[model samples]
Target: MLLHRLRAPAVLLALALTALPAVAQTPMEDPLDARDARRVDRMEKVVRELRDIVFKAQRTGAPVVVQPADTDARMAELGARISDLEQSLTRINGSLETTGHELELAKRENEALKVQVKDLTDRLAVAEKAVAPPEPPEPPAEEPARAATPQEAFTAARQLMLSGDYAAAEQAFAAYVQDYPEGPRIAEARYWWGKTLTVRNAHAQAATAYIGAIRGWPQTSWAPDAVVELARSLVALKKPTDACQALAELPKRYPKAPTTVTNRAAATRTQAKCAA
Candidate 1:
């Protein structure tokens, strides 16, 4: 009978030890509670003393002293605490999930706002360009005056040449030539026009002008000089044979020509590399 009593207490202790791991695995809201820890320590000490008593009775044929454990109420309270802790943890996890979802929605809204801002900016630029104004039209040009007579035109052209306005002189002389092909001073005008062309380095045009000036060998005061100028223009044109021929005719055509004219002709022959 005594053995039966001891074995009953041993079986109860074994069941209690097996239940401990399941209780320990339960979540706690506050595992560091001093009151709860002290209650657990008292229960463990009672179980250890009971185990030692049972072992001594079995070994020495003595009566076992088993202490009644006061742990049932405390274990029930701990279970309630663990249940509350699990509910609290569930609430906290749900709150965190809700916050993450709100952040995701906020990010999507922010991105949409950025796209809207860019679209609005482009629309504003187009609107500004559409509302801007057009430019004004240009004015008409003035016409140059006409000279009343051919002499007046010719005198104006000669004055332009004398004033060193070569560009205006060239245009004026060209206009005079067109206006008065049969003018009294046409040959002299051609000669002066040739002088302007030579200043402009238009040697070929100058040669043509000089030829026209001395046509039929007019024997005018400027005629001998015009022949010398013609030979000079031919030499500049790289026609040495034509230049020498023009120079050869100078003495026979204008024998009483000025010393200046004769001297220029002699120099022109040397420039042309003329023989004897």
Candidate 2:
């Protein structure tokens, strides 16, 4: 309202000035003519009167009157400008608030993504460990235990012989004979033991193993094989006569031997040399 009051007179003055003509052709006149002198005097008196009135008004603190519409219009324009500026401020604040919220949400999402990545990485490591093959444990430097009983040892020795582990089988059978001279499979063990020795080219040892099988268990199932092996071993030992005699007796003693005829003929040939 105070701004309106200040602007009203200025607006009225502007309108009055616009209504007046800015340019005019003046009547020619002498500089010091009586008619011009009278006109100049009249103008000077009018200006003096107006100056006096303005001076008096300044002295007095009287309120200046102005056109109501012009005053009100200028006030309305100012109010509108102020309103526009306030609305612009409100829009800027709202935008700032929205941007802040979006930034906060982005931060939270980033933190959650980091946690998910860490969890996935941890699970991946565990899975790799679970699936990766393990290295085999080193074998003990020493050999394992032997069979306890003589029969057990002999049986083990026979299995080893079948598997062609001749050296191990021979050791097993020797241990058996030393531990239990009268074990049930002694003759069988000795027979195979002798064959194992022959396979290893231990001729003397083979003869000894076969002789032990024949003398200790003459009635055993292994007796025929043992006797034949004994005769062959004796032949290798350069005792052909003893070998032939043993081979000749093999069939009579054990007629069920698998190669009775062949053994008898070979023994007969050797016995002929012995007789000569």
**What TM-score against the true fold does each predicted structure earn?**
0.47, 0.43
lDDT winner: 1
**Error at 220, model 1, angstroms:** 0.8
User: Which 10 consecutive positions of candidate 1 have the poorest summed lDDT?
Assistant: 137-146
lDDT of 2 by residue, 1-276 (tens): 222223335445544433332311244454567986688676665545444444444556354443245668899899999999999999999999999999999999999999999999999999999999998975533322477777677777778778877777777777777777888877777788788789868889999888878874477666876776777777777888887777767668877776764565466446446443
Candidate 1 yields a Cα-based lDDT of 0.81
Candidate 1 TM-score, true structure as reference: 0.47
Model 1, 104-196: lDDT tens digits are: 999999999999999999999999899878656433222224467878877887888888877677677777777889988888888888888
True-structure lDDT of candidate 2 = 0.71
lDDT, candidate 2, residue 219?
73
Query: lDDT at 250 for candidate 2?
Result: 69
lDDT against the true structure, each candidate: 0.81, 0.71
